[model samples]
Target: MGLWATPTLAVLPSEQLKDPALEARARAVSAGLRCVVCQNQSIDDSDAPLAHDLRVLVRERIVAGDTDAQATQYLVDRYGHYVLLKPPFETATWLLWLGPALVLAGGAGGIVLWLRRRPTAVPALAADEEAEVARLLGDNR
Candidate 1:
């Protein structure tokens, strides 16, 4: 593929609904759903068999007269919140959303504490050590 070439989508012509409006809705919903097999990709962008199945399922739900919310909820009901690309901020998902910030804050606090406790100055040499250094240098009065 050329450097600027866009990757082809997995949505085959046969999989698209006859109704354009419904197809658009299906695409929108597919964009929000994650591919179980390709965990990092949305169903719309993934070519995995599971992603194809999910794409078909979303289209089917849209054609069945389900509202966008209802269709999305149906998938959530079957697959749990993991299927959502952006999961809701609830008790179960709080850590997923907040864990990075919490870790960063902990790291920053540890660095601050270390800096505060570290030694800042060198101690002065004792009188005997200074006298020895002068004798070694052959200093005389």
Candidate 2:
């Protein structure tokens, strides 16, 4: 352990790729990665420690001759599809992809059924009843 010893510290974006192209690629990949700690923020946008770690890992993989797809798949393999901001529309994510539309369609169908089954409007007062009531309670004689 000399003064030159590389400290076991987390990697930063500036400490990562030398090539701007690779950095751009990492940025693109990071943009699609969800921050597991900050569930609503992408790793590229999040300041969470785990997000920084993930961003560094992505840059490392890209620098180490892995394609963007390969690096992304590596993360996906480790974290499951939950790490992805947009999961594929498959069996696992079908509910997420279609739940809203299905709800809307069901609501529309329910409204149609209700409209069809509605009873016809009844008069507030029938013609004969209106006349009799007016006669009984005459206006100002």
Candidate 3:
């Protein structure tokens, strides 16, 4: 309703781990995971059923003695890097990390090439045109 309103979290009381530490870790992991259905919202924020499943999965992994990274990795293995809000920079993901910079460089190169090819000199006015201008000034006086 208001600007900057906090999102209603999709994390239900039933899904939370009994241990506060594990619940905190699960929430942290969920915050970094993208909801496959929602795409843009994190699993922690998305209300979709798939997001809820992923949230539960994260808690399950944490309670099963997996570290935060391992829990995140489990999802990543099953869902691929798309599940991570920030994917790792790897051979398979090099383009994702560098594509913007490549585009910017290409645009900059195009501008430089266009500048070099642009005509710089202004053509001089003809003698008759200059005389007509002088006559017009005389008439105005």
**Every model's TM-score:** 0.63, 0.61, 0.63
User: What does the lDDT read for residue 87 in candidate 1?
Assistant: 91
lDDT of each: 0.89, 0.84, 0.90
Candidate 1 residue lDDT tens string, 21-124: 88989999999999988899999999898889889998888888999899999899989999999999999989989999999999999999999899888788
Better of 1 and 2 by lDDT: 1
Question: lDDT by residue for model 3 over 17-124, one digit each (tens)?
Answer: 888888889999999999999899999998899899889988888888999999999999999998999989999999989999999999999999999899878788
Which pairs clash inside model 1?
Answer: none
Regarding TM-score, does 1 or 2 come out ahead? Answer: 1
Worst 10 residues of 3 by lDDT: 1-10
Instruction: Give the per-residue lDDT digits (tens) of candidate 2, residues 1-141.
Output: 533474433345365578879888988898888899988888887778888889988988998899999999999999998988988799878998999999999999999999989886875998999898999989944
Worst 10 residues of 2 by lDDT: 2-11
What are the per-model C-alpha RMSD values against the true structure? 4.9, 7.9, 5.1
lDDT of 3 at 33: 97
What are the runs in model 2 whose C-alpha is more than 4 Å off? 1-13, 103-141
RMSD of 3: 5.1
Clashes of each: 0, 0, 0
Q: Score candidate 3 by TM-score against the native.
A: 0.63
